[model samples]
Target chain A: MFDPEAIERIRAKQRAWEARELREFLARQPESRADCRTGSGLPVERVYTPADIAATSFDEIGLPGRYPFTRGPYPTMYRGRLWTMRQIAGYGTGSDTNQRFRYLIEQGQTGLSVDFDMPTLMGYDSDDPRSLGEVGREGVAVDTLDDVEALFDGIDLEHISVSMTINPTAWILLAMYVALAQARGNDLGRLSGTCQTDILKEYIAQKEWIFPIRPSLRLVRDMIVYCADHLARYNPINISGYHISEAGATSVQEVAFTMANAIAYVEEVTRAGVDVDRFAPRLAFYFVAQADFFEEVAKFRAARRIWAKLMKERFAAARPESMRLRFHCQTAALTLTKAQPMNNIVRTALQALSAVLGGAQSLHTNGLDEAYAIPSELAMKLALRTQQIIADETRVPNVVDPLGGSYYVEALTNRVEAEVGEILKKVDALGGTVKAIEEGFFQREIADSAFEFARRKASGAEPVIGVNKFVEPPEPNAVPVHKVDPEVEARQIGHLRAVRAKRDGTRVAALLDRLAREAADPGVNLMPVTIELVKARASLGEIVGRLRQVWGRYVETPVF
Target chain B: MPPIRVLIAKVGLDGHDRGAKVVARGLRDAGMDVVYTGLHRTPEEVVAAAVQEDVDVLGISLLSGAHMTLIPRVLELLRAADAGDMLLVIGGVIPDEDVPALLALGAADVVLQDTPPDAIARRVRELVAARQPR
Candidate 1:
């Protein structure tokens, strides 16, 4: 990046300036902190000179679309085609969510990301007593093929791309999607979307896991094989770093831990007789765009480099696309404040910009009222408008990796990559992600980081403007939040009963029995068989229940 | 006597337990007894634990909008279980419109996400002050 002699001379001059000018200025006005660091607590130098990125050269940080693609993935990047504007949305019953999905598409949203309710997410049916109140509060409730069909009711499967944010029952929903597409006469090869089948992260962060580690990985493997053979365009698993960050991981930990899970998935798929290159290109990531602007940009760049290195060096991936780490980014929901609810609008816009500058393949800008309830229609429209404003008005996307050669960005990128590499080595030494998870490694780490952050906020050291620093009286009359109707749960249960009564109960039972038998045999790909069961009106709970007989439930180890 | 026994339990299927855990840790650090039932506990199980533990206060955190159903059930269970005297403090992404209903359902306090940890401790202390003269 810089000549050796010039870097040496610059370092000497910087030291001289710090000794004289910095000391004199500091004597009059002391620095805010004794030292400055990035959001991840990595120490930052006062001034990043050529000396910092002295070893870097053009080949290492080459143009976009090249190997070790630290800058960007595509050649022209946003100039060629802007990143997909995919807003995550779902609530109430499937039919209710179907309306919301249709609205988003009409609003010019480029992609669709589905958020399932707790009952559906945990693989439970609407009628289960445990799922009594939680049928459709958080997201849409999908219990059978009928729900999935209703959810995607009027949407064109060929045009829109969907990302399902589910893990424990991801494979079941994927089967439902395939069945729905087949029933619609849509080409299975052309169904573009991603199923978040990454179960390891569920145990580490979100705590929504159903089966134990080994068996869950087995399900993930089976889905990968099925997707590779059938749906070439759809991603079987979105190895998520988003939950890790939301659960209190540092940016570097988010990258390292997520990539660790990706490696575990790759190892599983390969060990299941599939080649790494065959499935690696379809592997995608989901990350959080936190409040730190430059740090978020550098984190994405470093993640790409680390992923490329991992695929090429370790797995010996054959194709160039196999080494590319294509990912979807969501604005950090943790950064949104419940206080001054309108301020969240600004926070979301800033985070959305960070995601765009970071070159995310897809983006989901959270709604302003998300901290209170499901977003109101007005709020969702405003969020979509924020993305549109950035895409249309902003000229930042005209060039690729616009900040590729900055001293500060390059140094931070290297620092993040090196720290994430260290964490990966630690994960590797602990045997793998599975063993580390069993030992509560990731959970403990996230807890410690979370506690540290909470401590900082409590002490008023890290001042959040609307929360800790600026106090405000409650606004008695505030934003109108979208609420799930009380009738939604009852209606969903009634629909479930109707489906059960209308379908051949005896036939459904026999298909479930066959499903249970096939589930016991690890060699079977449950997608096709599950599709048959769903076609016969066998509900999600029934199939998952049969497998639960074999796989058993997962109880998380307490971290606090 | 002993510190104020508080059971911080997560009700229903919401997996975002970070707030509950943070409040539990803060309460524990404030010299109170805090027992977390981990994630996905039903209302019946929560009330049963409240009765069995004989906790002075039961703090149930819910973010998945299941509170309208779960909170009323827990209150009913507490009354049926003869544990109606227990104070219930609810927290997490609860809508402003739902606050009055939650309070009418016998919640001692409806704490929003923006409330500080120390404020939570102080509120709990004030709530239990009258009954602590044993």
Candidate 2:
């Protein structure tokens, strides 16, 4: 091995050379003050050297697949396997979405990610008056087991992993997924997939929450325990920063707040009498990959390191897998533009590359038309192709943690780790993430960051390619956006009504009542009851509304 | 008079709300009273909120590739209640292909997702200008 001092001296010389070059360049043309801040508004120095990370050691940072996995989670990394290719999908009725799912699988997508309609997301059935005109509009409308079965009609749960992006009714969706697998003769224990059962982000970022915070926490705890025991291979909750970033938080806030939410989940599950090592391994994360290339990459590296440390030190996790942070990344939808719609392909390609370089286990590249509408067939194909190009053509996956020893990247990773730590401390001081949410700390921080970001743009401090800079007049025909079937609502509602009529009404009612009673009892785990209700063909509205009755819905008191 | 109350509800499956939230903040900053119903708000809930809040305008945001089906029902609800005077504006990831139909369903105007915040605020003001007569 090379001498540590010798390596330090070489790095110092390179830093000096960079500083000298920067000085010579600045002497010719002054750099803008705004050019110095990272995308998240953190100040960037002209150069970083060994001094920047003097406190960090090789062991604390560690090698791939080792303790405190700052470099990479797996020893072989992409050499063994590349990140799973996933594209977010759902629209029209269950049949329509099922077709799309089949098409995606045919296109060689390695995994599945389910997107639900607005009515279904908010725990409403297509037959409800409130669901009028909304069914199957944005996502596949799943009101019952029939709809759920239709969604994955031919897809095998045993072979391909699936991720359901629902929170308020995550348990219902999980139950539906389990029932679908069982019907196909797959054992519940053998199913592999993840549910975005992260209620904190729903309340804080997405605002798709159904129950109050405390009860929601209990529900999440129940899923963790149930999944640990039965669906050992399945992930119950994928705590997400994707929505938070999409909602306008900076990269630092994205990682920080998401880590805070993850901590809350770990604490809740631990309190529920589940071992940390049992569920922590399956506790996946979802983050957004944005245009801030290096910082975005650094954020991923820091996230792994922080999670590993937290799991080992805070939770006392025994297994290395339990401490490892496996994540799925989606290119930032907010970065796409409607002006030059096709340009989003290039943007997504760059963001996806960053996530890979930072070692994401799975990725979804947003379509070029994401800024304008739900992705069309052509646009989504382009999105999948973007990932294909990177994986097959670019040879980026051939190396493991390729950016690991760079001075700039290491410094940035350390900086992000420190910044996220500070944010974690703030959340902790507020008596954990739940209390922080009640006190509106997370919301306030995000708003403040968003406000500052907007102020920067307005003041010409930061640049957005299509928005602030590179002004282009709107094109007459940029590209046509996708239009969901107009009759989808009526058709979906009809199906839902038919199913309600055909199902055993007495059994459905009894199961729903049992779910309500179980929900009321904090100690009672609602997983088995929820599974039975979904199996009994109870509507999404009935299940969610029962919880609403027992654990009154939460109303947001906007903190601004 | 109290600030012109406007309710922004997201109907259907559109989760692209950066535009909606930004518009809501812009309107709120512009001194308009805004009640953001958050994401995935059902038509019934949105209409009930509009009726109860006595909102002067109802703005619905949808981008889930589902506008054609969702927007018309919201308008029909208003028309059926004789609350059609409440200036209806639909925004968020709206395709130009469906703009005419949305406007035909009593939407005063359909705001595209890429429309600037200032333009959205200005359009809402124009729609409610006569209604907010002193």
Candidate 3:
């Protein structure tokens, strides 16, 4: 924020410079197009000056690590510590994925982000009738505690943080993780990892709902409370906008919708009698960093500012950590092109840089071949190299907020903050997130954006490098694809059967009955009971199915 | 010409229906009768739906690499049901190496991920026109 005297001088000088400098330039170059816009279709001005940021004040754009942290979340951001190079990975059976996890850790990846296959993600066991042909294709298949144990078999759970990209059955997977840690004698208080326990986003974009909205919110609240009490070093919930963006939301909607979901979570937890600062400090977010470098950077800055102000004023938070918005970001997988798959490497690197510049706390750079298959080992290594290149080679992370004082970035930050605020208000006005979700509000908005982007790409208004332009036919020299073994399904099913045959049937039945009873009651926290069942050797399907009997499966109305 | 009746379905446990829903809308925009069999459908349910809807074209979308295992099953069921003539088109996150195997399993075409909505519409029309009764 500049003083008024300097602002007046800068404004007058900018006008004169524009008049004299633009008169000569406009005659020759004139603007190439009638309008220039960001990915969200927000207008981009020809020039920005100090006058553009004249309205902001010092308090609004406070110093990094201070209240309403506009510049960056922490004062010495990357200087104090490097962003976690967490690569998202998983494939095949448990042992297979464990090797990949260990491989990444050896390649200097700081964190492990787990990806679950469709059956696991949908809250069903591998042997479920509906899970045919999809046991471990997209991600690793976890049917029971045995599978979870094998997935992290040799990998030390304490040394590295694990982030499971599972929802719908997030609570179950988390319970299994806690149980496994306890069985391994790791202190439950020191279990460090993130379970993407964001169920609201599932109903909104991902469409992996196992129960209706209210029950789903209850599960999220239960996890938040349980983690707050038990898992001090763990992040119980990661209110996410990554899937929302992948589902077709623009940057603004992604922020607003994600924040609105966060508010709902805050309300539920606080009303459950958990204090504001109790769980809010550990609350984390997941976002997709699209290709637009400046827009994406501005979105991150604006997100921190908006969240801080909202927490301090609305929820009456008592701590700075509770006010600060910490988040993890990934390069946009939706923007990856399958045409010339190699181009994705460059795209991913650029997006990763944008995230780094935007002050992301942790980041995942998508593999180049992700659009084709689960990233091959070679592709995953290259993805990790991209992060290393950005952090170690580029000198990009040397400063806290190098672009903080720029005219364009600051003005764009304010603009994005205002836009996100407007969308959040709309979500609240529609009787909050759950009411809006039932009405298909978020779904419709995202579908519209997805369609618009698709149409733009189809028409060449938006020229994707290899998709609609400079296209090439399928070549022989393709990225070596990783295929889930054809026998993985049968072997996984056999393993499940063996686990079932060996476990004490009576104890399993009793634990499941108790789980069902607890699930039926509205005043129960299902985490402790879910943990008990998981420890009792109850499978994912058994636990989920028991609750499913009590709270019926969710059948969503198709929005499109 | 009656609209080319199509059943757009997701078989297997792949929860990604964004592509399926978009293609369904695109086909509907092109004036085809599109019936979407929502998420978590089995191959048997998909086959039964195709037979019941009497769709001329059946577009099955899978992003989880289940096409290799699930496609043959759907094809086998259709043949047993005497509906082998139905056009079995596929799309979504498919690898080029598996395209031939899927085609050998009786797929009509592998629609590219970013194909235009009208191109899908046109292809469905052309496929039906070729199979029309004399």
lDDT of each: 0.89, 0.83, 0.88
Output per-candidate TM-scores for chain A, rounded to 2 decimals: 0.98, 0.96, 0.98
**Worst window of 10 by summed lDDT in candidate 2 chain A:** A451-460
Writing each residue's lDDT as its tens digit, candidate 2 over A96-146 gives 988888888889899999888878888878877666666776788898999
Ranking by DockQ: 1, 3, 2
DockQ of 3: 0.68
What would the per-residue lDDT of candidate 1 be over residues B1-134, giving only the tens digit for each residue?
68999999999888887788788888998999989898988888999999999999999999888888889999999999998889999998888888999999899989988676788899999989866442
Residue A106 of model 3, lDDT score: 92
Worst 10-residue lDDT window for candidate 3 chain A reads: A474-483
How far off is residue A119 in model 2, in Å? 1.5
Deviation (Å) of A226 in candidate 3: 0.8
Q: Per TM-score, what order, best first?
A: 1, 3, 2
Candidate 2, what DockQ? 0.37
Model 3 quality (TM-score) = 0.97
